[model samples]
Target: MSGPAPLPAPYALDDVDQALVHALQIAPRADWTRIGSVLGLDAVTVARRWNRLTEAGAAWISCHPAPVLAAAGQGLLAFVEVDCANGSLLDVARALAALPHVTAVEHVSGDGDLLVTVLAPDLVALTHWVTRGLGSMPGISATRTHLASTVYTEGSRWRLRALDRGQIARLADGEPARGEVPVFPLTDLDHDLIAVLSVDGRATYRALAESSGASPDTVRRRLGRLFAAGMLQTRCEVARPLSEWPVAVVYWGRVAAGALESVSRLVTGVREVRLCAGVTGRHNLLVVAWVKSLADAQRFEVRLNERAPGLEITDRAVVLWLMKVSGHLLDERGYRIGAVPFDVRAAARTAPTER
Candidate 1:
């Protein structure tokens, strides 16, 4: 039996590109001057390289820390397995791509036809979605879901890596960071501090100090140093169930590299589309749409097919279960520092109800 195929990628990257990614993972806000200083280049050169990466669609800059906002019962981690009908491989993939919680989707070469990850607020909501919503679709032979127990990693790090020295060239006047980038060893103090922060992002320095066996002053200084060195960031995860929406659907499709922007625009144009991003393996451009019920999932699919022709479709694997999710990924020390406030602002201006 044939299995799912690799999804389309907007561009290809080289080793230097890989290195650039590594460096950025370490410091998203690192200025061109600092980057150029280390790489023996100038600010203009740093900008050009970054532009190249973005233009190629090999990378994107985003602040994705919503996972931290999710409280225990507020969200679910799900894995979906999909079965297709009548050589409709591409069609099925396109349909699933449209789902809102289907953050990661892949057309695979394996026992199952397709795999997907979904997020919702509760089990009752998820049950209604699969049984009445997605299950009603034609050609969907079967769907299974696995709910996540704990998340090992989340946010930008899951998809992006830090840029390394090889990938960067310093600006003509830029200076390198003092000393070899110090890799802070995970000390007992570090671990103790992390333990406290993991429980409460806003915990006071005094409390952290008392728990970590460090003086209050020392704790403050260490945290400051960590923040400056780009070893930490603060973020929260937020999650709501699919049933809360009036409509939900998985819109999926495969397009030529040239048509990515058009499809992305079309996909995001719809109000229901919640999350959309490319993945490392196949089944790129995974999307999730939120709506009231299954009927909405169908209507969106029809419109999507008409909007983008020639794009292949795959299976729409209804989410059944989620295995593990680590609400957030702290540094090796498991602590985050210097992160901006959770910006629910992007969607706020347009969709007042969404957060």
Candidate 2:
């Protein structure tokens, strides 16, 4: 097989780019006018800049079923470690990166060749994919799956911490108020709505109606219900290599079950943490972070130790390369090249047949 393409030079982001990114992280679908007002820029200017960034693949927004939704039987989430045969790590990583259920894939410096995050509709679907689908792939030697018991924080919560509280308050004032809404079981129409929004979180209601074959009124009503139920969440993600913080770090740590809640809350409060969770495994807690450099990761660990006394960081890994993140497959330069919509319906169709 041919060798992989040469690594692209790192793309640099400017100060305005960073500010806009932080703003979007706070409100992924906020109107440009509101964002501009808070940032002291013209609405059109803000829109133009965002268009440029997205067109360059430097940033994007994605929609997914919230963790609460997953917990309510919408899906299953797990972290997987894959060991590959000698000299075949890249090939295996590339293959797994292309699979729809595999949301995030990274080549790391550690015991495993790759660390992957997967989402599936149910236990049977997860089992079939892990054993038959992934197991059948060539070049992979072994796999260890750790189911996430509680997702305290995910990429959606990670922010640049660049915007001040007042600025954030001003931006929030422009958005509509969200009140507590009753939870309901997801319908087939809801699934289709999620599939459409997963690709474009800011899709218009008319466009959503067209795609899902639902009336505009029905589409708007269902979407509000989903939001009220906390079943859907939108996130703004950037090309990490092009952002102000370029380095990615993952830590597997052990904490007492009693303290998991407090510890996770503390860790998630840290500005650098991108993902934090309580998982099932030797190490019950996992923390993922983004930093300006490798040294920053070391410094963050020291702070973590100080803040969460008695927590043991069992192992840490630096992400050397990210092949996929939240279903968006990135190129060498970290620009989005393709997307695999998070559609749980596929699980039913792909399930292994019983003998």
Candidate 3:
């Protein structure tokens, strides 16, 4: 008998996988044919690799309302810090993860036991969600909520930087044209498309048509219009454990008057800065990042101090557990399993109805 087959090689994010993810990050819905061309590989090979990635839950493509909506007061975004009763952190994290409005749940190092990022349609909905929605939960806790005034950069902007300039340029082929942010409302069809894309941003026009009951051509035009209007954004995400940067941290910062906008712009340039926004809180700025280790988290602060002296880190939280990201529930090991579609017009799409 043939010797027992040698064990399969260890799974890892090899250079090729990184390149593929990098390409997708630049052009989230780029076809395999185009991405394959950029990577100098066969389209079939690229498609096979992508299938493996998604099947293993090592990566996924998801969509959410563009941050512009939050900034323009057309949608709501807030970060909530929660202090759970003794020994309820993990349970609370899982419970919070199931809430669609709670787009992200992170157990971090701070006085607070958990940090949750919430999305809603307006202030009233957000208040109700935070007060009645969360307050009614079993875990006993006090909560502090900070609303984002400006989103300089967020998860969708973070990239692996695994590909060179030329590769990225080729991958970004036929990028959609962007115009002034539309100061208007999205139609019911837009919401339908968004709900579908939230689960799979890479869905083909035909698939979107079938799911949303719009013709492929209509889906294309509406998607273009929504994009141009800055109503939605799509992103490719790799599971954290498979990434070079595994350690996550949240930084609460304060900046000098008249410097919030400029300083935020500068800080967001750091590749590790997954999120940098101006918020209404004692610490007016919020930054979230992923690094290689706890030591690297400190190094990030050092680099920040050197690069932007005006930004003061008032508080720091080393993420102990990241239960969810971008509406996708993750296992303890940080692999995507299922998604909670973010509804653009409602408080939350998947939340249970309150009595």
Give the TM-score of each candidate: 0.42, 0.90, 0.92
Assess candidate 1 and give its TM-score to the true structure: 0.42
The regions of model 2 sitting more than 4 angstroms off are 1-11, 176-179, 351-355
lDDT of 3 by residue, 1-355 (tens): 1111221235578899999999999888888888898999999999999888887788889998888777677788899998989987777787777675678988888799989888888888888777676777777478899998888899988898999988887766567765565746767888788878888999899999998888999999889888887778899999887888988989999998699888888899888889998899799999998999999999989998788888999999998878788888777667777787766444433333244
lDDT of 2 by residue, 1-355 (tens): 1222323464467778888988988777788888998899999999999888777677878888789867777788889999999998878877777665677899888898899998888888888787876677778889999999999999987776678899877766765444377566788899888877776777889999999899999999999878877778888888887766789999999998899999898888788888998889899998998888999989989998998886799999999888788877777656777677767656435522222
Residue-by-residue lDDT tens digits, candidate 1, 1-355: 1112212333234545554544554445467676666555687876688666443323434332233223324445456677777787556655554343444445544356666565554666666566665566666688766554433233433212224345433321232242233435434565466445543454678887888788999998776655544344433221112113423344444556677666666665555565554332345455555555567667666776676554555545332211111222111111211121222111112211111
- CA lDDT of 331 in candidate 2? 76
Candidate 2: residue 338 lDDT (0-100)? 66
Per-candidate local distance difference test: 0.47, 0.81, 0.82
Error of 1 at 228 (Å): 14
Show where candidate 3 strays beyond 4 Å: 1-10, 180-183, 344-355
> What is candidate 3's CA lDDT for residue 170?
70
Candidate with the larger TM-score of 1 and 2 = 2
